[model samples]
Target: MPHCLMCTRYNRKCPGPIDAPLLFVDTSSYPSGKKPRAKKPSPPATSFDVARRFEDGRGIHGSGNLSEEMAMVWSVDISPRHVWGDAFFQNLVAFFCAEGRHVLGAVRRTPSWLHALPRMAATPPPSAARNSSVVRANEALGLALRATSAAFSSLETRSTSLLHHAYGLYGDSLRSQGRVLQERGDKGENLYMVMTSIMLSMFESVVATTGEGFASHNIACAKMIDKALEQASTGPAKGRGNNPGAGGPSPMIVNVFFHVRIQLCFVYLTTSDDRIRNDPIMDRVLLEACGWEKRRLPLNMQIITPFARLMKLQSHADYEQLAMPPTEFEHEKADFVKAKEEVDELCADICDSCPRSCYNIAYPPFSTFPKIKLNVFGFFSCQQYCTSARDGQFHHARYVSDLSRAKFVVAALL
Candidate 1:
């Protein structure tokens, strides 16, 4: 049998000759002795061929194959370096080392966020990595860190782009985490997820654009902390020792505990939302985690505990003034005064025991901003309590003046 057109062109054996004769024929001018040869159809263009043609500056008119190539690019695990390049990564790392770490490090003494930095810096890019989880987490962290660094430096264009990228990675990380949780059924904790959540939460808090979203992230951090604590408490090595840091929580956990507490407090103070402020479980967990029962609280806790108490007092005063009867007002007022005095005494005691310069050496490396803001909020809370005790009948002029002073201090701190 004669070879078919396709096999003849490729020099392969043909099963059989073409079955049908050509439909159009020039019979009058046909060759006398030889049969006409069928024209060979061109082989289908492959992905590589199309890509090469496009790269060579040829116009690709086929949308279907181009669409498929574009889809594959998105579907694959593209690295941050691929999208933003090595220069961007290097600049981001430099920015992170100089400012981003310190900005987040100021939130807690233990430097939990810093724990992942070295690993991330050392790890190969996502395209070369075998573990998807680590890659996703690192991508989220890079985006968040870069976004925060850009925001702090007042780079609007860079910050906006990074913020958008960070949100996209954040969604991917969440979906990846959800799938893991479903498969594992909560048998173990996903530390990478926790770390990414913390970074994203810090990003949200620093950006200050998503107030409610930041609060929700804080809540998620709190839940993660709780689960971690429970795991630690029920570990195989339970009751190993009495010393708090001996067999107690790791530095990361400690930092996370404080970070969650401080953010929640700040959220409540700024927004006055009771959901986080009045969370009894969070309050109890924090107390235990900080080791108040052991009389060995960290320095940050020492400064924050009094403010937390004052916040509680403010919440109580609001409730009493709004809901309680006139007959019960006097007792609530006295309690409020007592709480204010206690906070005053606590501040006085801290100031007396620690020199003014020593105050800056406290845990979380109390920079001027946090130190002054802490005092501003503390004193302002006390002033509000005093005004409330006077049946909301404060001298408007003087109150406004004091508030202006406090606002100025806060502005300077910010």
Candidate 2:
């Protein structure tokens, strides 16, 4: 496979930053089936302005400016030392930039656009060397996916604990208006904000830690929810033995969001292409590492089955305005409870079965856990941006309650 030496960026100023060159070594100038005669190098001036002179045209893919067919070939053409080493790749890029080495031009432009991009010329049977290159490329994909999967598992555990704590505190405030901060709306809105914040942080981390090709914001969100139950095993919250406001924890709300996030992640992963999504080892790893297959809702379609129903219900409730047609809030709440329990059980199984090496919930570490703040800014932000209100007139004033006796449940298992 040939590797693309240059990656074309979408630039408005010049058509491209680099160019592909066309060179011809006449067949008559060399001996047939014998030692070929050396040809003189292209002039330095020709090479010097390669990027500027090359014709800038769309590749066969139409969408990508560069030829998608060159994905494998370009990678192969580039030295592995440069591919694997940051310093080497940086220096190599700089050297290429300085010399203005452009892409080798199309061998011959066939009548059809399909033949415009580069392809392997007819060659003899494959050798050991050819097989080794393929093995290395696949190996790189495996390592990147493996790290991404592991990181997601870690985030799941942390985020789940955060959801549980948020709901637990909300319940306490609801029961006795005087318990915790004297505001119900404030507490509920804050809880929602924290959950959203946790999700954002988890997704941001995925983009940061996973290498370029394999990283995705959605994948990180799914992993955070699927692995949340693991945090429960760490232990219960402290100073709760004598605290009357320490309400019994409810997994209902946490489970709803957790499952929703997980399903979304799986959908994106299923549709992803072979470079990142089509890793041969991913399904096996998911099965053994997380017991995903047994619990998953069949093909990707099954995963969204619940959401399909939810959307329908929301439509009937919000749009139809029909009498006795829409599902009641209690019924919707009950279904959410059922889904939450299932997710909880599945998460527990994953935690129990996961290998010590494969699973690391302690990632992001205790130090990275977000600090809880009770300022008015939290309330305003939640109402203004995080939660949807019935109108600008609607307010979350119920969250403002007394915290004197309310027990502080650590937001997450960490």
Candidate 3:
């Protein structure tokens, strides 16, 4: 029901249902034994060392103009001052162009194209299974999908916020253009529609990718579910397989979990899925295991509260809402800016939890928080009494205390 812009119309494109089953596979378990030994350290190599081997052949593999560019660039000893400064001047000139103005805001939004995010999967897929490659590929794919999903979630929020900001900027620009502020019909609406449309398109792309990922995970999990069921049924056990349903809710649990995953995946399949947007309700199962901590007072429900808030703000931005009165607009603008700050914090948190796979696809060191030592295990205070000779002071203290207590009790009794 918590729909994104693209998910409003493109409901059928959700891959979550198909990807639902894959979450159940116990990929963690295989060849159970003592932990594997750490590999010995290898010698370090530099970029120059590696680059030397591929120097001549570099960037020449493409079909056409690649060779020409390579030949031209390498043929001349281009001065740094000439090439680098010229390139900068070229960009400056291009920025002022009519066509460049259109994409400048969008391009400027992401200055760095690829970033390295910290990945969760430290271990490779299990080796003992015959379907090791399939399993490994699936795991890798799932990680990628999850990372994408997280990014989409983050992007959708920012996109919405941007739309809102653009609308405000359009209104301000209109005021400068000698347009009456009180008039209902303004160019802001048209500009907003165009910007909102782009945001919607982005959401559409995200949904398609998410759906594909979910479907892949689901197909793999379905096979696993079937296999798991067969093993439970045909395999010899102490008790008969009379009650197949009582597989400790193993297969069913997995089925349900991934099924929910699919539902969530597909839920955002349409921007108009009012179920997610208008009075959206979350199942208890989802609200709990979705990796968020429960709070006491304000009764915060989401696993990642800041991220959830960011998404909520994005949702508002994504949808078509009425233009507020100037006074209300100023208040909403402040709220929107606050949401943007919160979004930055949320993005930072997501980068922390799931590193390097963020917008830049490269891990930013500042994204990670400084580590503080937490005593997960509480401390215990032990009162120790050392005896001078075998059982001297300690024994005497104990005996005297007992004697005093006993005497007091006797006197009270008397």
| Tens-digit per-residue lDDT, 349-406, candidate 2 | 5457655443333323224223221211112222222111222121223211211111
Q: For model 2, what is the alpha-carbon lDDT of residue 387?
A: 18
Every candidate's lDDT = 0.50, 0.29, 0.30
List the RMSD of every prediction in angstroms.
11.3, 27.0, 33.6
Worst 10 residues of 2 by lDDT: 405-414
lDDT of 3 by residue, 238-284 (tens): 11333323332243333333333333333332334454433223222
**Which ten contiguous residues of candidate 3 have the minimum total lDDT?**
373-382
lDDT of 2 at 204: 35
lDDT of 2: 0.29
lDDT tens string, model 1, 137-244?
555555444444433333435445444444544565566556545555554244555665666665565566658777777777677777766666557543344433
What TM-score, computed on C-alpha atoms, does each candidate reach?
0.53, 0.21, 0.20
Which candidate wins on lDDT? 1
Pairs in clash, predicted candidate 1: none
Off by over 4 Å in 2: 1-325, 328-334, 339-370, 373-414
Question: TM-score of predicted model 3?
Answer: 0.20
Candidate 3 RMSD to the real structure: 33.6
